[model samples]
Target: MAGGNFMGRVVSYVVNELLVNTLANSPAFQRFAVRTSKRIEDASNLAARKRQELQEQLNDSLRKFEDMSQKKH
Candidate 1:
């Protein structure tokens, strides 16, 4: 029947895609991708911490300058 053929093609397509995806995400591929992602996350966190430290330093300097200006006046 036409319905049976349609169902068979659909099932075939689904199984093929699943197999291809599984191969693509095998252990070696997964390990490299996961490691790369973790490195990127670590880099981002380091940059964020550095930015916060810089901002704190700037704010402290501004406060000291403001106090010095008030003393002069």
Candidate 2:
């Protein structure tokens, strides 16, 4: 049983090494990684802007409500 477990680990290690080397050596993979990273950054920025806009709108609405309430009293 111990021997079988050792052999399984050895196979897994070799496969992992091969995959790592292939990805490191491939230009296409490098470009894909860069593009994906850029897209994630862009999406993050867009979300932040949208969040700010929503917060501003909410603040404006609250101010208007407070002004109307004060005028009534």
Candidate 3:
């Protein structure tokens, strides 16, 4: 009984590993991974652009405020 159980466990592990390896190497999974990676990269670029724009706006506002303060003095 113990030997039977061991064989069963080994078979199960092999089957599961093969299934995982097959799925990982599949064309569909590869395409999905590429698309997901591209989307993440695009989103990161967009966030960086937005941050730069905000920083520029903040700088312009600060410059204007400083100019006004200089005029008052």
Candidate 4:
């Protein structure tokens, strides 16, 4: 059982190394990685902008409500 476990680990390591080398050497994989990274970055930036816009809008609404309350008082 110990020998079987050792062999399984060795096989897994070799298969992982082979896959890493193949993907590292492949031009198509490199291009896909770059495009995917750029898309993720763009999405992150857009979400940040949207979050800021929403915060600003909420602040404006709060200010208007405060102004209206002051007028009633």
Query: Candidate 1's residue-wise lDDT over 1-73, tens digit each?
Result: 9999999999999999999899787998789889999999999999999999999999999999999999999
Most accurate candidate by TM-score:
4
Q: Which pairs, if any, clash in model 2?
A: none
Q: Assess each prediction's global lDDT (C-alpha) against the native.
A: 0.96, 1.00, 0.98, 1.00
Model 2 Cα lDDT, one tens digit per residue, 1-73:
9999999999999999999999999999999999999999999999999999999999999999999999999
Winner by lDDT between candidate 2 and candidate 1: 2
Per-residue lDDT of 65 in model 4: 100
lDDT of 4 by residue, 1-73 (tens): 9999999999999999999999999999999999999999999999999999999999999999999999999
TM-score of each: 0.64, 0.87, 0.71, 0.96
In angstroms, how far off is 5's CA in candidate 3? 16
Clash pairs, model 1 backbone: none
For model 3, residues 34-70, the per-residue Cα lDDT tens digits are 9999999999999999999999999999999999999
Better of 3 and 4 by lDDT: 4
- What TM-score would candidate 3 get against the native? 0.71
